[model samples]
Structure formats: structure tokens, C-alpha cells
Target chain A: MKRRTFLITTTAALAAASIPVARYYSNGKKNYPPLIMPEELGNFCEEKVIREIGDQYRKQVPQESEKAKLQQILLTDDAGKLTAVSDNAAIAALLDKKIQDDFNSSRILVLSGWVISVTEARQCALFSLT
Target chain B: MHIDARQLDNQSVIEGDICIIGAGAAGISMALDLENSAHKVILLEGGGMEYDDRVQELYNGKLTGHPYYPMKASRLHYFGGSTGHWGGMCSTFDEIDFEKRDWVENSGWPITLKDISPFYPKAHEILDLGAFEWGAEYWVKQNNALKLLPLDDNIIWSKMWHFSPPTRFGTKYKDAVVNAKNIHLYTYANVVDIVATDNVASIKQVTIKNYAGKEHTVKAKKFVLACCSIQTSRLLLASNKQAPHGLGNDNDLVGRYFMEHAELKTGEMWLNHTEPLSFYLMGDKTKVRAELAISPQKQKELGILNATVSLMPLAMSKNTIPSIKIWSQDDPRKALDTFHKYSNLDKRNYIQKLFSKGFYQSYGLYTRSEQLPNPDSRVVLSEEKDELGVPRANLHWALSPIDKKTVYTINKVLGQQIGAARLGRVKLYDFLLNDDPQLPDYTSGGWHHMGTTRMHEDPKKGVVDANCRIHGIDNLYVAGSSCYTTGGAVNPTLTLVAISLRLSDHLKKTM
Candidate 1:
């Protein structure tokens, strides 16, 4: 994706989510995609996983240490339908598939070039901004 | 005088004031220092001046845990020892590596880095490396063009490594050892068994054998096992006369606590800066290069293992993974040779090429980290015996949970530091981001074998004492990486030679 187009689309999604937008770069910015913090994505993934599993998560995984156990279920497609994906694309798609797989239904859509949960789209419009 | 042990009589009994087994870096350094002394030193080497297949087979054994190099070919069984193929990247172990960190179990050396600091300069000279200096500040003073990364010193600082002409001990010290008046250099004298007294309190004599079928008994006032880590422990465990479990097997700590610098390519860093980070890049003619090491303060605060990260441009790392493929070779030396054959790229120029071609600047982040001491990751006697009639050393290298945690935490720490500084971003490999019991396939051993016969103040916990003397044996001492209480991320050759020099000084005082 082109840098200027990606930034404009991502900025629009962030604006919709009520996140503040700013002049990200001054003078000459490298034409590369802006980097995202891993922990930020990790936190989003963890919360989504907990909410998806609901009461069963607390009953099965007693401690925060056991949260890693959820990774096997979240990262892999149980139905074996996760299309082969590149490393970077896999990040966004896996989370989307995880939410769909847990509910056993397709409840996600692409908005402003971002794949986000349809139910949470208005609240987390920046979900797939990267 | 230099003697070939094959010419000795079948029942010959040779005696010396001090017997140093193995003619590797440790043994040669000790012998060289003791040259012209009043004490008569007998230096025994397993193979001839060159590599020998029959003698190399003595190192053959089974590997059970975590895929490892083939036993026989992992180490060279020759006069100069493993130094024959050493890369000569030398650095001293940090003080933190020796301190008693409560977080690191089986940690703390009985002696501190200060105890061996005095001898490091002499070791550097022995290794034929440059001036007695470490850290980036010292090198920057020498070469004004060098620039350090603007990283904070408190969080991460440069750990300097000085390269050697990589003196091959066997070739470099061959003439000196042969010509030394007080030292007797004997090739093809493989130690078969160690015999101690009835109580096994002291070593009485060691039997040496040759593939030519000649046998000889060497009685000495004191014995130093200067063999590499694996064989040193293997010889100790094979001798079961007085102690059914081996000479120093009373506490079963002889072959335990084995360690290797767990070198892994774990992640990548993307920096926005257009200017080259040339200081981080090692120059062709430069003797010193720096890698990013977490500060000692950070180690205690974070409760993590000591590790250093080196960055490589992504374009230059295309063949890095193929070198690790050498691990599966039946003959590890051949595998090593294959890796060396493919590693002829000029890394610095390659990175420069990427920059000039307008390729995005991304680095392949890699680490050389310390392994927490684990008794289970050890060497034991295999069912098969060598031609010398001693059981081969079977190595089962197991990584502790702490080992995995260390790798993950350090990478995380690096990511945080880079992010906080706004110096681009780090994308950690999925394995590090997740809690997986199994390590990635790209994970490879550093070929640095250490901690088999670790030194300690207490006999129960360690095979050797602070003075490098075996626990119960009054006359037996161990030299080389085998006596290392902890294998620091730094290469072991420099420290191993320093300890050997220290042991030699102690022997001089004792005699």
C-alpha cells in the first residue's frame, strides 16, 4: 500500500473512533508504512480473547500465566479454514478469524480499508488501521 | 623434549612433577607460563599434531536432548584443540555473570571477575589479540571515526569484543612447547583411565594409551585435567575404581551443570533514520566490534539472564539460517566446514549496498545469551566405549524454563528500549511473543561447551573448588571451560585461558 494513502485511510478510521489525529511527520518522512506497537495490538488481542471465551476463560485458565493457552485456539483455525497468509497480514486476519471462529459466525466487515468486528466497529474503528 | 607416546613400552611407567592432560589452549598456556621453571611438566595430547580420525572417535557419543552437534566432530581432538577452528571473538565475562543473582538458580561463582582480572591481559597476549581493553569508549578513543549508537548507557550499552589473529594454539605454540626445558610435549597420549587411592582422596596415576596398542602409566605429584569440557568430565566419570560412580562422583556433580551460549536469531528491528549505524557494524580491519548488552543494573532489576544483541541488515542475513542447518550433520566438523564455506560474504559492504539501492533499512536481530545452570543439561557416560577402553561422553542438553523466559524477556526489553527512544520498532518472532516449550528450529548452539565440572566453594554443589582443585582429590585440579561456574555470554576461550594461568600460578606457589 502507498504510504500517503495508507496514512489518510488510517487517520480517517482513527477519527471515527474519536482518537486524536496529528501531524505525524515533518519535512521529509520515509515512504514506509508507520510502525505499530506490538503491545498495543497484544492488549487488544488479549481483551478480545477474554471477551470471546467469556466465563469459560476464567473457569479454564485460572491465572494470567495460563492466558498463553488461549493462543493455540486463537492463532489456529480449528475448522482448518484459515487461508495461508503472510506474516504481517496474518496478524489482522487471525484476530478477525478468531472473533468469527469463537462466535461460529461471520460478523466482521471491511470499513475504510480496515477489517473490524461489525458489532464493535463503531467503538474500535482503528482495530485494523495498521 | 617432544615424544610420541606410540613408541613407549606397553607397561612403561613415566613420572613427572606435574602432569597436564590435553594440549589445548588451557594446557598450552599453563605449560608455556611454567616453561624454564624448576618443576617438570608433562603435557599430553590425544591426537598427533594434526586431526586424526581414530582419536576423534574417542569423542563420539549419543545426544539425547535438544538437537545438538554430533559428538565426535563438535570438538577437534588435536594438539591445539578446538582453537584450530575458533573465530577469535574474545570478550571478558561481566561481573554480573559471577555474582549471586537470586533470580538465577545455580548461579554465583565462588570467585569473582576480579579474582581473574589480573590474568586476562596475559591471556589476551597469549591469544595474540590487541591491547588490554574492552567497552566502546576505549575503542572509540583509538579510532576516532567509530561512533556508538545514541542508546542510553543505563539501559543498554556496548559490550566490546576484540578479534584475534586467532592464534591456533597447536601451530602457534608447537615450537615453544617442544623447546621448553621443563615441559615434555607428548602427542598421541590419550588418557584412558584415572586411578586414585583406596579412599579416592587423591589421584595416584593416570593410564595413557595409543591406537598403536602401547600403554603407559604416568604418576605425578599433581594432575590437571586441561581437556575440553566434555572429555574432562567423560574421563572423570569413566574412572570407577575407588568410587563406583567415578572419581569425583560422590555428589554426582561431575558431569552436570553443562551450558552453552544459546545463540538465536529472534527478531528484527526497523529504524527510520537514513544515516548508517556504522559503529554497530564491524569493519574488515577493525579489531573491536560492539554488541548491545543490558546493563548489570537492568539484569538485577528485571531478573533476566545476561545477553547481547547484534544487528545485521536483512539483506545480508539471507544465508544466516542455512548455517544452522549444519546442526543435523552426522559429522559436525564437516557441517561446520560447510557453514564456514558459505559465510564468505562481506557483511558491512552488503548492508551499504542495501542503503545505496534505496532498500528499506531493517536489521535481523540476533542474540548470544547465557543459559542458566541446570544439572540435567549434562554429559554422562554412553554405553559405547572408545578405542581407549573408556566410555564415550553422552551429552543430553536440556534447556530450562528459565532459558526460554530469558530469551523472551530480553527481546521484549530491547523492543521497549527502542520504542521508548522512538528509534523505530522491533517485531519479535512469534515464538518469543508466545509461551512455547519448544524452541524455534533456527535456534542453534554457539559451539561453546562449558560448565561440565563447575567450580564452587562447597563440594556438594560443585566438582572443583575455588582454586580449581577437585573436591575430594588433593592433587587433582581442572582447567579450561569445564571449571567455569557459569558460562557468560562472552566467548569462553579468553576466560578459560585466564583461569588456566591462575591455576598455573597457584601450582607454582603450592610446589
Candidate 2:
């Protein structure tokens, strides 16, 4: 085979493989970044528990406008693709600080009888969309 | 010697150096303190050694305002008073409870916690509690298994509580009181009237009567009303022939400022992981447990009343009913049986089974918070008279906006602390989510009647003085929670006994 043709074919295959991976890591939305990473929740992020919390979050915050405002507060990067390449450690730290600040500032809501921080509620709100 | 007033001849006059009316925690504590003293003490009890329906009927009356436990059911008319059914939870008032906060009107007490600290050890002995120590560190150090949550001490801390074997005063001190040489206990002797001099400057004597168709007079150098708050105020208000407005009602402050510890289930705590909250759990073998209390500084900053938050297993707590709902019968015995049937006592085995499995991921939060003293919440004389011809008491229990605020803020603060520690989450009940000043129908009292004849240095401001003496009258005093200037978040038994002992000392010095 010709070297030029083989090189071009290999690069195209690699690019196609990376596209699905990026989609899997996104918030399952068309233009939004992930609000919370699964690893950030530590042992609390069981699939069943997340779905239960997501269900409750939807019940508490039914309005789309409110959900959009929460998403904006959680994801500061308007350049959506830049957030996809953002450092995982920095995102986790920022999320933790936001949860603590929500508590300090009294920005809290009760979902399924569990008093939770708005940051965590926003995460559940985003997860409910998927 | 003990005398059954029912056996005495009609119009017989009983004489003594001092006469104490009523035989409850306060009366008995004072009598016990004066045991074998030089002065002869005459102790009067309205009922016999056991519960009597006829005597209990005397306490029946109307509820004018807020929903409350029936007056007949809330108190006992027998020798031991309400101690027969008390749950035996005891804790001292915080320093903030005594101070006059700018936010809480009519708040400060003439006496501080320092004045009452000396008598608490003795009160502890009377209540069958151990070691006078209430600090959480002291209790936690003794038991290594009890671990505290990793919350900031500045925002929230553990407030320790000591449980009693629940000494029934009737059964515990009946022999001691009846056998004392200087203490003359007259059972079935209910005070009917308080007679005073022409100028009404001093009490001449009190008339006594019983269902045995007998009436008599009792004369003493000094008279002390040691009945529980309602009865004390009732007796003072009924004795109106001499003063026209009752014995100490010149300023019309006799039956005012009624208060109680507002108790209710506020919220739930959802732990991130199952926690061994041994320090917060109360078991049969556990003598001391801790509740989460807001710091004084935090309360001042928030402009809220002092409050304490208790945690329980949600599995059992969710099934339990409120005490006010269960204790609805007019008869004390029936009400108690109904309460036991529906209360957490019925789920003992279930709770034990749950406890054996260790902790759970979910818990329920209950609050016992203070109520601001309100003049409108009071006890007044009802027009309906009992068989003994004395007017029955009518209670108007009114709670304030600060009370609901206190409970709501307590649960909210606890939620914040738990979140900050990463321990768990808290979901408040629907009632606390609103800004409405009206408390929910589920709100209940601790069955602690206090502040009808409140103490103040000035006559116009209170019914009694700092020494518990009636402001305008000499040698006439009140001795019970009725003399309390303000009710704290804890139960009233221990503090009532302590203050009664203090009054005993004062009377002895004057003699």
C-alpha cells in the first residue's frame, strides 16, 4: 500500500473513535457540560440512588427556566467544548466549593425528604434530563 | 404524724408554725428539706395516697385557646402530683436562658443560673440522677464507644442529658414525710379559702374542706402555696372575699405568663453512610445521651430562642404519633393508657431489634424548644365550680411567632452543619417551610405548666418577688414552677425542686 494513503486512513479512524468517547463523557445534553463527575460523589453515586434523587429533583424543580438558570450557575464556561477538555481535579474542587457555599448561603432544597445543597440538586436536575 | 382530714371533726382548727399547701414535687421537696426542723410544718394534700376520680375531677376545666391536653389529664390530684407519669428527662437551663435578650421581650430572670447551680446536685439526688455532670465530654470520656459527629463546635455542639429511674415522689417519700415528727401531713385536706386581716396586709388563716362533709381552719405563722402552677393560681384566684380580686391579685398578675416547652417532629436526616450515633441514642442501659444544641453566640446572631435538636431512628419515629393526639381523654388514667398504647413505648421491641442491627442511613429529628413568655397565655378562674365549691381553672395557651421561628431555625441550622461536615442531609417538615406565624396543629407542650404566678422584684410586674413571696402580703409565698419568671427548654421537675429547696432555706432563716 502507499504510505500516504495508509496514514490518512488511520488518522480518520482514530478521529471517529474519539467522537463517541467525548459524547459519552458529556452531560447527555446537546450543548451542556457535565455538572458533576461520578467519581466526585465517592461511594454515594449508585445508579439506583442517582435515579431516585434525579426523580425527586425533577418534582421539586418542574420549570425549564429554573433548570436552565441552575445549569448556568453550575457551568461557567460558555465555550461548551472547552469544558469537555477541562481538568477533572479542578472541576471536582469547584463543585465541592459550590456545595459548601450553597449551605453557607442557605441555598438549599428538600428532595425526597433529604435536605441537600443546590449544587447537588442541580446535578440531579441535569441527570434527570438524561 | 399523718392525719386524714376526712376523719377530723367538723370545724376543727389545726395549728402549726408553718403551713405548706399541696404535696407535689415542690411541696414535698420543701417538706423534706424542713424535716425534723425546730418549727412545726403542716403539709396539706388535696387527694389521698392513690388516684381518685372525685379528686381528679376538680382539675377538669375548659380549654379556651390553643389545643392542649385535658386539664384533668395533664395533672395528677394525688399525693405525688404529676411525677407519677413524668418521663424523667432532666437538664439545666443554659446561661442564655436566664439573660434578657433584646429580641425576646420580658426575657431576663431576676436570678441567674449561678444562683440555681448550688441546688442542682441536691435536685439530682431527689430525681435519682447520677454525678451532677452535664457536659458531653465528661459523658463521652466515660464511655469510649460513644462517638460524636465531626461538626464544628462553634456552630453546633452536643448537649448532654441524664435520665432518671423516674422517682415517683408519692411512693418514694410517703414514709419519710408521714414519719417526720415536725412535719404534720394532712391528706384529703384541700384549701378552700385564704382569710386575711382587715387591711389585707397579712394572711390570718386558710380554711380546709373535704368530701367527708367537714370544714376546718388552719392557722400558721407563714403559709406557702406549693401546688402545681394551675392549682396554685386557682387557689389564689378563688380566695377573693378578703381582697376582692383574690389574695395577691391587686396588680392582676396572679394567673398570667403561662409557658411550656414546645415539642414537635421538625425534620429528617439522611446520612451519606450509616453512622454509629451512640452518643445520641438512648437505650435502657444508656444513662446519658446528647442532643445537638445551637451555641449562644449563634442564637444571638440569628435572633432566635434557645433550642435543642434530638435524633431518633426514622423507622420507629415515623410510626409514632404525637402525644397530644393520644393523650386526649379527660381521665388521667385513661389518657395515660392511650398515650402508652400509641407512644414509642409500644414499639420497644421493634426499636431494640433495629438497634441491634446498628445504625441506619436515615434518622428523624425532633425539637424541644423554648417559648417566649406571653401575658395572654394564662390560667383564669372558670365560672363552673367543682364539688368542693371552688372555681375550676381554665387555660388559654397561646404561642408566639418566635416559637415557630426557633424550631424552624434549629432544624435549618442542623441541616447546614450536617452538610458542612459531609455527614448527611436534612429535610424539614412541610410546616417549617412556610413563614406563617401560626404554629401547626401538631405542635404539643411538654405538660410543663409554669409562670402563672411569676416572680419579679416589683409587684406590678409579677405576682411574687425574688424570694417567692407575694408582693403585697407578708408571710404568704408561692413555691413551684408557678414562681418561674421564664420556662427553659428542659423539663420543669428538677428546677422546681431546686427552687423549692432554696425557698425552704429562706423560710428557715426568717424563722
TM-score winner: 2
Q: For each candidate, give its TM-score against the true structure.
A: 0.80, 0.87
Question: How many clashes show up in model 1?
Answer: 0
What's model 2's lDDT at B37?
88
Using DockQ as the measure, which candidate wins? 2
Model 2 misplaced regions, further than 4 Å: A1-72, A75-90, A101-114, A121-130, B339-359
Which lDDT tens digits does candidate 2 get at residues A36-57? 4323232333444555666776
Report the TM-score of the second chain of model 2 against its true counterpart.
0.97
Candidate 2 residue B293 Cα shift, in angstroms, is: 1.5
lDDT of 1: 0.73
Deviation in Å, model 1, residue A16 alpha carbon: 44
Question: What's the DockQ for every one of the candidates?
Answer: 0.03, 0.09
Q: Model 1 over residues B345-415: C-alpha lDDT tens digits?
A: 32334334434432235566778888889899999998887777888889998777767777766666676
> For residue B271, what is the lDDT in candidate 1?
61
* lDDT of the structure predicted as candidate 2: 0.79
- Residue-level lDDT for B115 in candidate 2: 82
| Model 2 pairs whose backbones collide | A115-B426
lDDT tens readout by residue for model 2, B421-484: 8776677887886658967877889899999999888788888888889988899999989998
